[model samples]
Target: MERWPALELASTIRHDGDGGVTDDLATVQGTTRWIRAQSDLPAGHAPAGDIAADEELRTEIVALRRAVRALFARAVSPAPPSPADARRLMPADQALAHLNAVAAREPVAPQMDWPLDGAPVTRLLSAEDDPKVRFLAALARAAVEFLSGPQRTRLRACTAPRCVRYFVQSHGRQEWCKPSCGNRARAARHYRRQRTAADGGPAPGGPS
Candidate 1:
């Protein structure tokens, strides 16, 4: 068995860490609680505990949670990273933790109530060939991988001001966390929108 992946997964699960866990790995108590709360309808589920009303979303959430948990299991294992595995899953390890953090609920059933609590993620995380689940699992799997030199360079980040998010920064002049951030930066420099002859000088190229 390993350690970090489980811890990383636990960090992603905000619901659990605050209150601590009992038989944490055995049962997804915090994730389930979070799911129930998010998917519950104010007028119904919360009021009457109606699982049938929100079955789909709950199922999807559970499946995603399970898939992510399994990914964590695979990542932090003591086994060495194999060349074939690296080729297939060329991604930054930190991204795995990030993605797992965002694995909130997704609806799958029409309605839900006292839905049977079984294995978390099912077919996809298991041996099944479900395309969508397979896709998500693959992404999770990649996060724990090591890429080639070209990929590492392409996927690196910039130390530019307010730009810490990872991205394909291979292009020589790349900076800024996101285009929106850059746009706002440029806009902030502007004094005003447009200037008429009566107002003052031209729009001043709207600051760079």
Candidate 2:
């Protein structure tokens, strides 16, 4: 399976009910822990151990997350970007280009191994240190690969209330990220219908 740690990194923020957001990566310690936890998650082949998080590193992480989020927003939205949005997207565009460049420079080759019964397997030959910047660069490359691949069309932003995350839709009927999110969305719709009825207004999607 392809690893896309940048997606997880981008999901560190959650929507608040009051038009705000909560940051899971709010602290340097939190950022360090999150990066370390990546190795434990399924499909996460990132190296184990905590990332170094000085003030400068923390700022870089924040900026990387912002760039990832902005790129995702542009990809997921149907509308074309306005002039302002176009300008705002410049940094993200540059970041993604840099990531692709880094990954391109890494050595990759196919080799036969006993583990695969003599089958040739492709591997990343670069064994670089886990500097904070390099770690984030790895994630950025994964994100770029995923977003550019065929699976990009399957990407969906979760519509669950107070949840800000991206998910790959496995089926045509799937919408929300999880069962709980679907339940909450359904209940909210029902409640809105009841309120509209009580107010003698047209029910949503019913009549004009």
The regions of model 2 sitting more than 4 angstroms off are 1-3, 16-20, 40-46, 79-95, 98-117
Query: Candidate 2, after superposition: displacement of residue 62 in Å?
Result: 1.9
Runs in model 1 lying further than 4 Å from the true structure: 1-127, 130-133, 144-149, 154-165, 177-180, 189-208
Error of model 2, residue 54, in angstroms: 2.3
Across 1-208, the per-residue lDDT of candidate 1 in tens digits comes to 2212212332343222233323222344543444233322121112211222234434444444444443333443343222212233424444455455432111222233343676433221234334334333333333333232243434423233333223345365665435764675566544244333238655555434
lDDT of 2 at 115: 65
Cα lDDT tens digits for candidate 2, 1-102? 344576677778766556567776788887777778777332222353756566776776677676666777666677332221334554656767655664
lDDT of 2 at 89: 59
Using TM-score as the measure, the top candidate is: 2
